[model samples]
Target: MTEQLSTTFNSLREAWLQHRPDERQRREDLLRLRSAFKASLPQMTEAISRDFGHRSAHESMLAEAMIVLKEIDHCLHKLKKWMKPQRRKAGWQFWPAKAEIRFVPLGVVGILSPWNYPVNLSLTPLISAIAAGNHVFLKPSEHTPHTNAYLTRLLHDCFPQNRVSIIQGGADIAAAFSSLPFDHLFFTGSTAVGKKVMAAAAKNLTPVTLELGGKSPALIAPDADLTKTVSRILTGKLFNAGQTCIAPDYVLLPENQLETFIAECQSQTAQRYNEANGQTDYTAIINESQYKRLTGLADDASIRGHKVIPLLSLNDTQKAENRHILPPMLVINPDDDSAIMQEEIFGPLLPVKTYRSYDEALRYIITRDRPLAFYIFSSSNEPVENALSNVVAGSVCINDTLYQFACANLPFGGVGMSGMGHYHGEEGFKTFSKVMPVLRKYNPAATDYLRPPYGRFADTLIRFLTK
Candidate 1:
């Protein structure tokens, strides 16, 4: 096994050395990969549903298929321009010399994908890496083994393994994979895991783009329209059963309007889903562990005197044995020390906290490191602008959440504990390439400021310009 692993690594290194694939080849491969990916969508949905036990097919299409296809198209539309060598202005000292920036591809990239967004999270980065003219090694989440296997096979059928490979295993294999010194690394996971991945990449001084998650908050000011607020909040939470990195971790509401927000949210939740048994419009959690973890947060809050309401009420007996299923839960008066509040609630539980005023809510969010994404739901433009201007999250949404990630033109990633660096859009190309600045010498007579005679005139000229 070690011999094969070493051989594979050596092969990739050789491929990277030999890779001078032209623009035409890159486009052809991308188009072929696109067709293969599109063909697998139906099966991908099935594997995701089997992995989560009740993943909504429609939700999968909206979240995964729509976004991935749009990204593919976005890259294809702009790839030619993005691949062109950009002309840069030469300084006055090099008046006759030409300067330009070329977008050279990184040799090989190792992408560690998260389970929450198994398809788009994994494949979208691949698109960027490929578009940037580099080969890739994708490591999808082991938690979704079926999806992982299917992705591997899909790529294998579409392209040669030497150009793109999929490595599958549990944590041990992932640890081993991370230790390898790839040209660049793109990781999408929790903050804790992101730290480890960053440290591993540091061993080889490999540049990385970490897309970690934080407790992203959504604020609803007093002047906000309640109907719109409820609809947007519920839509954000219901998507992927709230297992999204940018999903609103919690909501801040006006003090007296807390009950009204909860009631409206409850109504909005039911309107999105059918009340029939096991026939939910929303998707399910990834596994029992996630389900239990989500329920534990609710149970902890409920035991601590906070009011917990399942927006879609259910029978007690059926609910106990259920896996991968949880009605939208809203926790009222959740304290700071509660587990749900402390951790990134990557589940369907929404904690409601009442702020004394708009400034109070703003203060709470500013105290923490900026989140990957922050959202504000208000009819008036002032509060929305206030939140966007004040908070330092990676991306801000007005009266919505998680939609920024869908726009192929927008750069997606995080800041601080949420993550470091970004990928997506043109930034994706920059992330995978090293921007080297070059300057050429012009006519000797014109560049005589540094003739090195150790004279006062030369020193004065150098000091005048450089200083």
Candidate 2:
């Protein structure tokens, strides 16, 4: 496996070096990928659904298919302009010389994507690398074997193996893949694993962009509308069963309104999901291991005397394990030191914490490790502005959640322990590109006057320039 990985990488790298893709070829590649992706939507949806036990087709279309299609369209529309050399002003002393930066492909890019949102995560970065005109090698999550199979076929049909290749395997293969000497490495997964990926990439001095997960918090101000806040929070939190990296891991709101928020959450969950009828609209936990982890989080909180409020009926709780579908639940005021509060809870369990003052809430978020995303729900502009100005996060969405990631124009990434680097939109293009600066001289040399030793003209020019 190691030999095969190295040989494949060498072949792609050699091909890229021998004949780098031109603007036209890059555009054609993106167009081909877009067409192939659209043609396989139905099969892709089924594969993803099968991987997750019962992933919703609607959610799959809305989140995965729609998002990737929009990204492809975005790249196609902006590729030409992004490829053009950007003009930069030259210094007055070097007036005859012209300066510009050219956006060129970085030989080869390797993408290591996670199981959650497999299609979107894998393809979005792939689209960006293609837009920047780089050959790519991708490693999808092992947990989503069915989806990975579909992706392999779709990508292979779109391009030759040298242009784009999808490799599938478990941890051993992943380790070997990460250790390869690629021009750039992109990883989307947990912070713990992100560290390992970075360490591996460091041995080769390979630059990496890690899109890691952390405990993202949603801050609800006193003036915020409880109904709207609860609805938006649940929508983002429950989407993909709260398996999203930027999903609201917890909520911090006014102390007096905790019960009201809980009640509103119950109402919203009942309205949105129809678990009683066994409808497949609600997504299940990805696997038995994930299911057990989520259940264990809630159980630990419950044993510690935290009020675990189930939005669904008692009957649904009995059959939840069999289906691996843990309904949405609120863990009221779990201790700050508890497991749920300490780790990134990638599940349907939302820990609601109360804050006496708005500053207190801000302090709570500010003191923790910088998160991938920070959400502020406020009716008035003061608290929103305050939070925006004071809090530090990779991205921020006012009065809502998850839509920050949906914006094709914004850069999505993390900070501190969350992760590093950005992607999506022009940032994504830049992430996979080598923005090389070039200086072209058109006429007589500007520095010729200063080249002589102990010359009076040189002294005058130096003084004038310094002054």
Candidate 3:
């Protein structure tokens, strides 16, 4: 397996070295990929659903299909402009030199995508690499074989094997894939795995863009509307059963508004997800292990005497028979040291913490490891500005959640322990590109007189240039 991986990478590297795609070729490739992806939407949706045990069709369309399509469109529309060399000012010392920066392809790019939102995560980065005129080697999550199979077929049909290839396997293959020498490696998963990927890539001195998850917080100001704030929080949190990287891992609001927030959460959840009527609007946990881990977090909190409120009622038997669907719930102020609070909650369990003052809330967020996303719900500008100024995060959505990632123009990434690097829109293009600066020198250069050995003319020219 390792030998085969090496052989495939070598072939791709050689092929890319021989002939990189030009602007017209890249646009044509993107257009073909977009067409194939659009045509396969129905099958793609079904494959993702099968992989997740019971993924919502609408959610798959909105989060995966629609978002990827929009990204491709954004790239297609902006590729020409992005490809144009950017003119830069040359210093007086090099008076007759013209300078510009060219966006060039960086050989083969390796992509490691996660199972959560598998299609979107894989294809979005692939699109960026293609737009940047690089060959791609992708490895989708092993947990989603169905989706991976579909992706392999779709991508291969649109692009040649040397241009775009998808490899499928478990942890061993992922480790091996990360160790492969590529121009750049892009990974989307947990922070722990991200560290390992970075370390592996370090052996080759390869650059990496890690889109990792952390404990993102949603803060509600004292003057914010509880109804709207709770609704948006639940919407973002419960999307994909809180498996999103930027999902609201916890909530911090005023102490007096705790009860009101809880009430609003329950009301909004009931209205949005009508399980009693047999509407499968909600998504199930990805698999048995994930389901166990989520339940374990809640159990640990409950055993410690923290208030565990279930927004939707479901018995153990029902939860098991329904493919491990853990309903949305709140863990009110679990101890800061508890498992649920310490780790990223990639499930529907939201830990709600209260703050005595707005400053306290900002402090709580600022002190922790910078998160992937920070959501602030406030009507007044003062508290919003305070939070914005103090709390450092990968991205911020003032009154909403997850919308920041949907915007192609915005650069999406994390800080400190959360993760590093940005990818989306122009940032994505640049991330996958090598921005090379070029200086074209004319015959009548200003530095000709200053290049000689110790002489009066050289000294005078140097002095004048320095002055």
Best by lDDT: 3
Clashing pairs in 2: none
The list of candidate 2 runs beyond 4 A from truth reads: 275-277, 314-322
Candidates sorted by TM-score, best first? 3, 2, 1
lDDT of 1 by residue, 210-293 (tens): 999889898988988888888888888778889999999898989899878877987777666654644546677888888888
Worst 10 residues of 2 by lDDT: 313-322
Off by over 4 Å in 1: 1-3, 276-278, 315-322, 445-449, 456-460, 463-467
Tens digit of per-residue lDDT, candidate 2, span 305-405:
99999986534543653468788899999999888998999999999999999999999999999999999999999999999988999999898999989
Q: Write model 3 residue lDDT over 314-416, tens digit each, in one string.
A: 6455566576789888999889999999899999999999999888888899889999999999999998898888988999999999999999999999887
TM-score, model 1 to reference: 0.95
User: Superposing all C-alpha atoms, what RMSD in Å does each candidate have to the true structure?
Assistant: 2.1, 1.6, 1.3
Q: Number of clashes in model 2?
A: 0
All candidates: TM-score: 0.95, 0.97, 0.98
Better of 2 and 3 by TM-score: 3
lDDT of model 2 at position 86:
98
Cα displacement (Å) at residue 53, model 2: 0.7
